[model samples]
Target: MSDPHSTAPVPSPRRRVGRPAGRRAGDTTTRDRILDSARQHFARGSYSSTTIRAIAADADVNPALVIHYFGSKRDLFGATLRLPLHLRDQVSALIRTDPDDMGEHVVRLFLTAWRDQNVRTPLSAMIRSVFSDEGAADALGQFLATHLLGPLVAASRRDRPELRVSLAASHLAGLVIGRHILGVAPLARADIEQLVACVGPVIQHYLTGRLPAVPTE
Candidate 1:
């Protein structure tokens, strides 16, 4: 008979304790997977209910890894919803310098960003994604607080910061969509200077001027 040890079957190799091979838990691929999972969960009406554990499961990562990559669910959502630009820095600069010209500067800055195909393309996608994905609305609202409305709010030394933020946000959103997205008559075709002249004051008012009083019932 063959030797007992030689005839015996070899034991299977033990799997490693760490994350499986091929991709690291903290790699870009893993991060993108988390974001993609978040986007899917948001689009599927599960945003409010989704958890870090769920997202990690979907991404085949550990919950600790999710926390490692994004501190919390809201932060994960923010990461997923972030635009492709350094919005805070750019807007903050306009808000800081040239108080008198800040409004026009803001308009010009917007027009300039939108004029670039690279900027417009990603921005369009982000806008559409933000507005259409209602599941992510709360997260989007939080993000807008910092990304779009934060600058105007920061620039203002006004009474109601809420009013300033809301007013500026509404006006800018309308301006962008009306001009670039919908291509609405005069706004769509109007010259950049004309837009700056017309819309600048409105934004300026929202930023630094007095707001209309709320009527008591």
Candidate 2:
């Protein structure tokens, strides 16, 4: 070695510096902007109507960034449509109590949950998607059947409870769709107490009231 003690050429501190740090910060900002824009777009219309390019433009970011952050439109939609309540747990608790007035309790719980800001936007988006997209329709039906209906049916523990649970759930679902989703007339304008009074007995009938059985003859 000509000079073992000689120091190796010092690496330039400049080599360690450039746009990487700035680029990373910019990326994070861009991702947040994209998500905010996406939520706004989805809230105003169905998922089918909100395009990725439009969201990217609204966010003031490149289209690629939207895909990079949220993967696809479906994935983004799902992310945006999350509920405020722990639906399974809440419904399970309500049904487990075996209340005599289950319908009133259920309706109250539903209305209260829907009134939350976080819940309302997602629910509105889901409702719009269900009407406009076949995939969304299937997803929403499956979600309702599994989470909403399935739990109540399992917890009913009464005779021929499947039919009862399904009927009750259908009635409640229709009420919500008409009033909240479709914004139907009197139903939409009706106060919460009025709705509960009008709808509770129908659900109660489905849940517990006796019906004529088919004749064996």
Minimal lDDT window, size 10, model 1: 117-126
Residue 195 displacement (Å), model 1? 1.8
| lDDT (C-alpha) at residue 188 in model 2 | 87
Give the Cα lDDT of each candidate. 0.69, 0.70
Model 1 residue runs over 4 Å out of place are 1-68, 71-77, 80-87, 115-122, 129-132, 136-140
- The candidate that wins on TM-score is 1
lDDT of 2 by residue, 107-179 (tens): 7767766787766776677677776697666545554555555566556666776677667766766787898
Residue-level lDDT tens digits of model 1 in 1-217: 6786786678999877964332665578878887787666654444555677777777777788788888887687777656446644677676668766777877777777676654554345445555656645555456556765665667666678877767776677778888876779888889999999998898888877877788899
Steric clash count of candidate 1:
0
